[model samples]
Target: MPATILIVDDNELNLRLATRVLEKDGYQTTTALNGFEALELCDQNPPDLAILDVMMPDMDGYELCRRMRENPKLKHTPIIILTALSSVDDRLQAFDVGADDFLSKPFVPAELLARVKVFLRHLEVRAVGNENQMARKIAVFSLRGGVGVSTLATNLAAGMSQLWGDETALVDMAFFNGQSALMFDLPMRNTWGDLAQIPEEEIDAEVLNQVMLRHSSGTRVLAAPRSAVNADQISEEKVSHVFELLQEQYPYIIYDLPHDFSATTLVALDSADKILLLIAPELASVRAAGMALTVFEELGYPDEKVELVLNWNFQSQGLPRGEIEAALKRKLSIVIPYVADSIVTAITMGKPPILSMPETPLGALFEDLAFRWSAPEQKKKRPESPTDAWRRIAERMRKRAKAASS
Candidate 1:
């Protein structure tokens, strides 16, 4: 049976257009001229998803959405607000009313269908109740700057989103000067600055959603503030609360941490499930990693929880991997081969290799890293509705299992 959609709009022409387009695409669509009729229809038979227009005379979409959320029978159904009001305020209102998505009016059919597909697919998965995997929180760090910490963090977050088609968040904890948003080519519409002054008690899912910037690749970014002064306004407690909220909502959370071990940095590092402590193939980076390891030990963080990654940022001669491992007293868990030209181009183009070139060496490396460190439960069970990315994961798992047995 096809998924049913309820499209509520006051304009008959708009209703017919949406209904025809959706039905033509093999979805079962029902239409209503106002929110009252839509509510009556929902009571009779709730839709899998609701596409509501905002300007209904009987009751606006925002009110209808709030009422629908309060309805026990229709609470879990995803609601998407479609309106000509494309302003940020309108979108924020929709989110406040419990909308799962928002689309501006005069939307393309393909874009509408794509959003519907993702919404339905997520609904189907939730209906199965197979998602027991807890969110994995990862902190990508380096005591030394320019060791590709942010680069790796960005790719890992984006890669995980692409792989599972689930929500992933990249949190830029480098409050002073973070570039997670720039790497994704996202405008500084909303960032951590929004939450810096908000009372800690008021910081919840809704507030966090308002601050997070969504990327085109399905990843969300909690960006650093644009101004350096705003960084101080954000407290360590606020950082902790934000991470707590993110951990509950996102399936994967990657923190792009700053170089120093400040109070805020310590808070994030403490909450992390795994720490990717990156080091370059240079003496300075090696010494920094060693110091970081010593601090991790002092903080009682286990050796297994930290993965020391060797990033070859430059092709010039530097300390050997063996010597670095000996000095740190731990074997390197992963190595990122130098691809200076490609990496530079990726940065300049504002497309991470994971999104722009997943088949490339750097891209595959990040994908493999994401797979290796994901929650163990996710690795054990296959999702009910598998995407192309999921299929690739399954194939990779099979190969790894076979190799291990052999």
Candidate 2:
């Protein structure tokens, strides 16, 4: 679908130029001479996007942005400031006034079109979340093997999907040894390994879904490969491709990562909206989790992106809350009380505790945590592998050259 864009500027020439450029690029644009007119037009007929010039008579871009944010009708609309101000402070002020993006007056037309495309892509991704924030990406992973990583991931995704009345997908990036399929009694038929045979150029959401199998409860599983050789073929490039495709198609993309680090794992981690590092209340789990935290920190993962999850599934080796805090020297974000016997039985029976037994203590835990982690977030990083890095650098140089010419 074509996005409806509103171009608001005091100067008629600027408006005409922007409108012509956007229309030429296959966008539907509506023009307003000033902020007052734009506001009235928006209240009457809302647009999917708006580009406002900073300097205007009666109302400036900053005030216009503030007013747009205040209006419920235009609250979620993407606003780009096309202005002559290029200073850091001016950009910060624009952001403070609720601008989604900013553009300088003398910008290249290609950059303008690229920025507009970015806004449109972003708008499409966020349209669903604008009404319901709970159906967003949530990643559950761990450093140690048996801290209930898959258990938490399976149940949490099932619980969330049920609560939202939407489908949730559990992605088993644990490669060969992943238990996500086993947890749901799903087979490895046409696993992520199948994607390796498909040409990367033709891989889209529809092709990706062919490899995924649906559970009886509307939960989907992208099970890992059964063979190590096949898993080896599923490289970082494939993982990055999957994340991009999934975010646009699925409401949630939960990854059950392998116990150790891999290039593909890092790409998945970087693309995650939230990370749930499952840790047991023991010294071993704490130490392992600390090492994992160091890795994430070294890669510049924000503290807010990771939440240390204490999975207290046993009594003997259990450590107190203070003991955990003292061991890791960090406050825990969430802790699940030990729901020992029944939850294990459900998993053994190849059923998610959240769906099979929603009234159980473990199911309730998943539900409460799902509600708490419903806010939208994104990570800012380039590709993970060295080859991807080289490709990105080349792409950047090419773009710079193109911009210089333009």
Q: Please provide TM-scores, in order, for all candidate models, with all chains considered together.
A: 0.73, 0.59
* Tens digits of per-residue lDDT for model 2, 1-406: 6789999988999988999899999999999988889999999999988999999999998999899889988876778888898997887788788776678996678878876765565345455453433336777878788889888888877665555444677888888788787787654445877886676878887567656755545567888887788887876777777777776666676888878887887887888879998899888888899998899899998988989888887878578888888877788988888777877888888888876775556665666565456543411233244332134334555686999999
lDDT of 1 at 240: 83
> How does candidate 1 fare on TM-score?
0.73
In model 1, the Cα lDDT at residue 282 comes to: 91
Give the root-mean-square deviation of each candidate in angstroms: 7.0, 20.3
List pairs with backbone clashes in candidate 1.
none
Instruction: Give the runs in model 1 whose Cα sits over 4 Å from its true position.
Output: 1-112, 115-133, 396-406
